[model samples]
Structure formats: C-alpha cells, structure tokens
Target: MKTKVQAGGVSQSPVIDIQDLSLVFKTADGPVNALHEISLTVQRGDFVSFIGPSGCGKTTLLRVIADLEQPTGGRIQVNGMSPHEARLARAYGYVFQAAALYPWRTIERNVALPLEIAGIGRDEQRRRVDQFLELVELQDFKKKFPWQLSGGMQQRASIARALCVRPELLLMDEPFGALDEIVRDHLNEQLLKLWLKTNKTIVFVTHSIPEAVFLSKRIVVMSPRPGRVIDIIDTNFPTQRTLDIRETPEFIEIAHRVREGLRSGHD
Candidate 1:
C-alpha cells in the first residue's frame, strides 16, 4: 500500500518517506523480526503520531528514521535525503522519554550544547538559546540546573535544548509519558503553539490515544509484534486546535475511530 501525506487538510509531498521498511535483530539464539514492511509518509509541517502496544516496534521504527538504527531492508528518505545524510546535516531533533539533561550544566548551557558542538558563535548561540527557552516557557529557569527543576520542567528544558538549533524535523518518543496529567496537558498545548510558530515537521510516538488524537494532524496506527501499518487516520481539523476542540463532537468521532483501529489490531 502507498503511504499518503496530509497537510492543511490536503495531500502533499512527504518530508519523511519510508518504503517497504523492515528490521531484524540477530541475537544469541537466532534472528528476530521486529518490523515488517512498514511504510508511511509525513508531510512537512505536519504533526504525525505513531501509536501501538508495547514491543510493537514503534520505537524501533523511529530509530530507523532518525538513523540511530539500521533497517534490515527497505528505504527511508528524510527531506529527499537518506536518514544518515539528514543526521549528519542535523536536520532532525529528537526528544526521548527521559529528559537526559546534564546534571552539571545550567539549563541555558544545556540548550546551547548543540550549537557548541556545531561550532556556532557564542553570541549567536546565546541568542538562539534564549529564544528557544522562551518558546518552551523555560526562560526564567535558564540558570537552574536540571536537578533543580521538577520532572515536567526538566522535560521542557530538554525540548528547548532540542529546538535551539531550529531543526527542520522533530522526532519525539513519548515525551510527556512520565509527567502528571495536568503538566502533560499544559505541555501538549505549548507544543502545538511551538509547532505552529516554527512550521517544522514533527513525527511523534505515543501510546496515549487521547494525546495522539489531540495533537496529530494524522495518526499512524500499527499492529502488534513484527509491526506494520494498520491504519492511517486524517484528523481534518483546523490548524488552531485547542483543549476545547478535544471536547467537540468531531474530535470525539476521530478518537473513537482510532480506538476502533487499536481494538482491531489487538483482536
């Protein structure tokens, strides 16, 4: 099946494309298949979510697209370039489940680490660091160490770090899974604003049905072990999504559909 790209309620060229993707791991016992013929496309500036049960290869597939893991077969292109090239060019930013911040570095310096590695000038790095911290609403905490903040605040700082370079694509893996409900909701809303402001393509992985439904322009539902694409649902909602939208009938309808898809996969 061909993957489709939906952006602004219409189809468009994919910013990230995967074709006949497959992955296998060789262990002491034998080879184990993790993913099978997984294919999908994410259009530029679109928020796409990957949802599935645990051990469904959701994270594995993400690693492949991020060039952190190699696929046993198939092809992947990010902005028309191979994943490796994209990684080398720093075209993508990744947010893992944990904040993974350095205990010693202040929040501002943490955000500036990427720029330092890229050899960016100190003045320009400071400018971008401040801009992103404000973007994530962590500007006031820039001088604090990671251990000084709460879990949610640390995650925000990590996000600011990721966005400091203004990457073309953002890849996130259950970024809010560890936070409380209230913090999670607040962060979700803030992320949507950042997405709109930056106009950057985003591919997010999550197991929360409501979270996926609320944030995604499209949701890619995957099946169990040896994961493969099972369904791709377009949200068709307006760009200015809000918490109120999640309570609307249209939003509920789409969420119901996603639930049905997940049930079908489990059965």
Candidate 2:
C-alpha cells in the first residue's frame, strides 16, 4: 500500500519508502536470505549509493526497487505506489553495470528502442534521442554501432538511453565499475553534472567506496550475507562538485568513514 508518513508536524513523504523489506531466494542449497529487515527512505532528488561487498545484496536491493525482483516479505513503495505499479507507470530508469547496447543497432537506434516500444511518434522519438545524445555528449557518435565506439562512449549511450524515457528516478548498478580509472573519473564528473542538471533521484549500487563517496549525497553501507544497512553516511559536499574535490581532506574523511563502516559490517 502507498505510505505517507508525518514528520516534524508536517506531511513529509518519501519518493521511495521501503519498510522491513526481506527477500529470500529458493536456491537448490535451500533458502538464501538476500535481504533482511531492509528499510530506507529516499527523498525526491536525493543521490543515494548502496555500497557493499559481493553477495551483500546491494544490486539485489536495486533490482527490488526497479521491480525486477519481488520481495518475499514486508513492503516497498516507489513514488507512492507499489514497485510493480510504479514500474508500469515508468516512474524510474535503470542503467545496468554493462552498457548492454545491441551490437547490430546504431547508437541512436538503441536509444530510440524504448520510445519505439512505447509507441511514441517518429518525430518525438528522433527529437528525444537527439536531445539525450547531446546530453551525454555523444551526438556525433549517434550513427555509429555499439561495437564501433569506445567502452566509455558505449556506456554514455546507455545512460542517454536510460534518460530518454524521462523517468524521475535513476537506478544505476555500478555503471562505471569496469572502466579504467581515467575514464571512470571522466564519467563520474559528467554524471555529477547530469545529476545536478536533471535533479533526478538516483540510487546507485557500487563496490568502490571512492566512487560511492564522490557521487552520493548519502552512502548506505551493507553487511555481507543477509545484506542489511549498517550505516548511512551523509556527505557535507555541495551538489556542484568536480573531480578535484575528491582530493580534499573532507572527501577523504568521508571515504574513511565509509571504509570503517564496511569494516565494522564485516566484523
């Protein structure tokens, strides 16, 4: 059911509200608890990152929010609706770890795929594809196939495709985890600029603490197996941030705290 809670004597609602959410997988090895007692509230336009080791349920939680996976117990509301309902309404966009662009399709065609499926008009599809291509600085490469572009460019195309639907929430699962440090840094800067310009609520899942620290307003640290949130560390940095800010002591301190949180979770 939809939830609207009151706080500070005022009506405050969360864009994504998860309450005691638990998911168990019926594997051959028996029941595996992917997530247990997971609760989180993501306000509108908030940039939140979930960081944890492998098998820690970070990606699983993201998938749950996207309605790709169903929760075995408890409740989850996305944009004041059930996750399935919200997904059907196109309330959010998802970017996977891999670009997953079609090798046969041109970058522009790949970006236009969703619009085409949604029965958007030809002219409108062309307009949005062009607009988002430029948004991700890939307008010049639009005509090229995915195999023709560099890894970073391909990921940028994927991001542009995700934004084409104009969803309010962007759920990314380690989109740049495989890129080299230089390329990752560049994309991180571009992503921050894009986030600032669009003001969409983004929930990113990553294993890199530095990437989490640099991109998120709040970092959700998770434990290993049962994947519970051990800590939620808020950043003091301003929204208008550049890569140079990562070198500052403040940034390092936040990274250190995230590291400590992860360590404590392991303990």
TM-score of each: 0.93, 0.95
Cα lDDT tens digits for candidate 2, 223-245: 87787999999997987888888
Instruction: Report model 2's TM-score to 2 decimal places.
Output: 0.95
lDDT per residue for candidate 1 within 89-204, as digits (tens), equals 99899999999999999999999999999999999999999999998888899999999999999999988888887887899999999999999999999999888888888999
Local lDDT at 48 for model 2: 98
**lDDT, candidates in the order shown:** 0.88, 0.91
Best by TM-score: 2
The 10-residue segment with the lowest total lDDT in model 2? 1-10
Top candidate, metric lDDT: 2
Taking the candidates one at a time, how many backbone clashes does each contain? 0, 0
**Native-vs-model 2 lDDT?**
0.91
* Minimal lDDT window, size 10, model 1: 1-10
